[model samples]
Each structure stands twice: as structure tokens, then as C-alpha cells.
Target: MKARLMWIAGSLIVIALLGYGGLSYALRQNPHAVLDTVDRIAGPSGSVEQVAEASTGPHRQQRLLVYRSDDAAEALPVLVFFHGGSWAHGDPQHYGFVARSFAEEGFVVVLGGYRLGDEGRYPAMLEDTAAVVGWVHANIAKYGGDPERIFLGGHSAGAYNVAQVALERHWLEEEGVPESALRGVIGLAGPYDFYPYDSASTKAAFGSAGAGAESQPVNHARAGAPPMLLVHGEADTLVKPRNSRALAKALNEAGGRADTLFLPEGDHNAPLLSLANPWRRDPLVHDRILAFMREAAKVSVPVQPQTP
Candidate 1:
């Protein structure tokens, strides 16, 4: 009886905290464990499988987590996501909520993690992103995904990671992944035009690359690039909304399809936080992304998830 009462009390505490929007702080303090617990408490989302490495090469060293709804289609559309931690601190294991949210929505979600901090410098991170795409292009079919219907997405620095891969052809070409394979790209609160790095996270990850156009995704925007959705918050002082605005402007001017969204009340973390189940306040972000992916991929409609 005592243990049962304690269990009830603990559950109530968690419920209260989540109800009151304490998840953001919980994620900041311990993202991996928090999301893991959230995933479990949320009940069965889908089946998840992890690959140790995408490939055997040095650049192919990143890990991937694949999530599929219990009733996913034979060839479900794929969404590969990378987390944000100033490009220094993040792990694939931390985004189960993200994976579950999309997987539950009837998509095959891939949560990817690359090397971080000093070891993950500029080109290394880009290389890993491309490598992960290449691996998914080659192997996702075996995991019940359509290799041709791949969409790339990320938050913050991870957003830059996907943006670079989608905008720049060389990275994917080097990995034998044709740029056309990507159905669309989504970047939330990404820094695309920042050249003169001032933040410690930017400096730590990009210092070696120098303040050159070569490392900026905005510079790579051109005609024939894959469709993109860049969402940022006007209130975001961390990365700034101009990055997305500039990139979208450049892409559209160059004859590419890039959409931009700026939320007035949104901060740096709002876009990402909206992806979690509990804090999913606004439906526009999810709706727009889904519409972009569906339209770009030309899917007839959303596939209904089967019972797990």
C-alpha cells in the first residue's frame, strides 16, 4: 500500500510538472533520460531499431535510430532528424519524443547523431550528415522505408547540418546520394547566414572553418535545390530569424522552393519544443511541415497508423 501510494504521488508529480510546462526545463537538465521516460509513459508509439554505424568509413561513423508506427505501410516515407545542442552536445537517444510524435503520425522517423564538440568540427559534421543520408538512401528500403521519399530535418545546429546537405550538391554527390532523392528539408531555428561567429557554440564548432562563405548554407542556395521549409522565431535572440529569411529569400530568387515561417511569440527553443507531445501547442508548424512533405513527395494522403 505504501509503495502504491508512492507510485501515485510520483506519477502525479510528473503529471503536474508536464502539465505546467516543466518539460522544457527537464529536457534542458537531462534530455536523454527525460525523453526516454516520456516515451515510455506516453505508451507504445512504435517499433524502434538502432544501427551502430551508417557505414564503415570514418565519415560514416554516425549512429541512427529508426522508428516506425506499429501499423506502418510497407514503404513508408522517411524523416531523418538531428538534434540541436549548439553542435557540441546532442545524442540520438535523446529525441525519442520527436521520433514517437512523427512515427505515431504514420511516418518512418530516423533520429541521427553525429560527432560533437571539438571532434565534430565543420566538415566532419557535414560529412556525417551526408553519410547518414547516403546510408539511408541505400539501406532504408530494408527497414520498410521508401529510399526515394526521404526528408531531412533538424533543430538549430542540426538544422544547419540538414540545410547544408540539401543545398550543397557535393556532399550528397560524394556519398552517391543524388540530391533529387530528398523529397524535402525542414530546418527549425537554424543559422544559415551567420558568418562572423560570436557565440561560443558557433565558435567552438566553426572556428576552424573560418568566416568564409564556403561553410554557410545561404551561399549554396541555388536553382534545382530540393524543396525546403525553414521555420524560425522572431523572438529568437540565439540564432535570429534573419538566417531563415535570408536563406529562403536566396533560394526563391534562385528558382528553388524554400518556405519561411517566423513566429512572433516564439523563442529559440519554441520550435523544437513544439515537436514534443506535451508542449505541442500550435498545429501550424506540424501542419505546414506535413503539407510540404506530402506535396513535395506527391503523396495521395496521410497513411493511417495500424495498431501496434
Candidate 2:
């Protein structure tokens, strides 16, 4: 009877594993299908040019997608993007809508892929991000993107990366990139702090050394860092809203231009993923982000905020 009970338990474990695997597969596929449906119905007809090239190092060759409203290759504002996957599993392709939206809005958009957690950690991720930004500054004008108006933005872990590369000037300085080279930073549900590793989820990402307040973005706030815009949902279960709020407070305390958007009853995935949809748009989120970008760029154009 004991042996039979053990066998039953083993069978249940196998079934549970299969069920979880199937659910994960569906979650991954569903997002893509939603993106596809949106694209088919509302994709822009403009012919965007793409150039795939290797970076300075052997890390990985990146695909640079350049969408221009005009044929003349002139200097235009640029938006450099990093994707998020908890430092595990995300690619540039997953953020097609995010990049395309900014590109279509008359900014040259760069969506870059970096090495994941399976690779080295800490400085490695920051190094890759800096390399990509440098590459864009050097090659963006060829695609009609202005090298002068380069902004860094990302979602989730990508957001954390953006904050790191922007806040920690040492990385860019190492690459000979002047602090002024960056126009601004936009982060969506990013993990800005690394300390106190209070929660198991955060600790898992940052490790034990980050438990101190000094390890958090709050610890690195300074006036020299570029202006920042932080966005997060009030109902975010994965990353709390305090992440953005704390970062904003630090930036402001440091006399830096900082703003934040807190989505009402929105979760982490819904807020970022809804960037592809107009109907599900959060006026506070989209308009505030655009405002931050414009203010950072010093552009005088007024942006009409989308209705919630």
C-alpha cells in the first residue's frame, strides 16, 4: 500500500509539471498572438530600414531597426531601448511594439538585445548596454537618427539596466561617453534599488549583498545623472509601486528632474504590454512618459495626452 501511494504521488508530480509547462507556453504564445493581431490591423505601412551589425565586442551582433518619416538621412532624435525578462528570457523582438511606437512618433528607435542571466552578471549587463548606446551614437545618423537626442528606456529588468547605465556614470565614462551624451531616461516597472534584498524575489535577482540601502537606486541619486521618468502600476504584484516612487524622490532630492506615473489598478504586465493598444491606453502613463521625453529633449511640441 505504501509503494502504491508513492507511485500515485509521483504520477501527480509529473502531471503538475506538465500542467505548469503548458501554462507557461500559452502565456508566451498569447502575447505574441496579441501583438500579431494588433499589427495586422494597425501596423504602419512605412518602409523602415534595418541594419544588423556586430558591436565592438564579441558579446552579440545587434539588429538596428531605423524607421524614418523622410528619405533624407538627417539627424533626428533617437530612442534607445532595452528589453526585460528578469535577466533571464527576453529578446529585442519581444518589444517590437514599444520600439515601433517611438520610431513612428518621429524618433529613431533602437531596440537592442543583451546577454541574459545565464551569462555573467553585474557589470557585464551594464557593459553590454553601454556598448549598444555607443554603437547607436556612432551609427544612428546614417539612419536619420540624431546622435544628440539619445534617450535610454526599458521595461522590467531592462528598466533596471537603463537606470544602472544612466545613474552609474562610471560605465559610460569608461566607454568615453560624456554624461551629457544622454538626453534622459525612461523606466517602466524597473528595479532601481539593489539593497535590503528584503523580498525573496528581489533577493533572488540582486543576491544577498544588495540588502543595504546603499545598493538601491536611492543610494546613487545625484544631480549629474540625467533626468528620469519612472512608471509603475499601483496594483503591480511583481514589482511594487514604491520602486518608482522612491527613485523619483531620490532624483528630486538630488535636484534632478524626475517624474512618475502610477497606473490605477494596473498590474506590471498589463501596463507595459498595453503600450501596443490604443484602447487600453492609460493617459496618465503615456502622456507623462511623452512629456518627460519632450522635456528631456527640450522639444517645444505639445503632446496630447491619451484618455484612460
Instruction: Give the TM-scores of the predictions, in the order they appear.
Output: 0.85, 0.79
Query: Which candidate should be chosen as best, given lDDT against the real structure?
Result: 1
Q: Pick the candidate with the highest TM-score.
A: 1
Clashing pairs in 2: 76-146, 193-216, 195-210, 196-211
User: What C-alpha root-mean-square deviation, in Å, does candidate 2 show against the real structure?
Assistant: 11.0
- Cα lDDT of model 1 by residue, 1-308, tens digit: 65345445555656888798897798678875675575455434345444333542453337877877666778888899988888888777778777766776667888887888777888889888887888888888887888888999999999999999888888989988876678888999999998777778888889766646789999998887887888898899999898998898888878777777778889997787667544453566777777777777774332321110
lDDT of 2: 0.67
Encode model 2's per-residue lDDT on 1-308: one tens digit a residue: 65345445544643564577853565566654445335323443444434444455665533334445555346768888887777766667656676556655667778877776645255556778888888887877787777778889888888888888888778777766677768888888888865656665455455632335544567788876787777888888788888888888888778676666677877887557666643224345555666677676774232322222
lDDT of 2 at 228: 79
* TM match of model 2 to true structure: 0.79
Q: Model 2, 10: alpha-carbon shift in Å? A: 45
Total clashes in model 2, counting residue pairs 3 or more apart in sequence or in different chains? 4
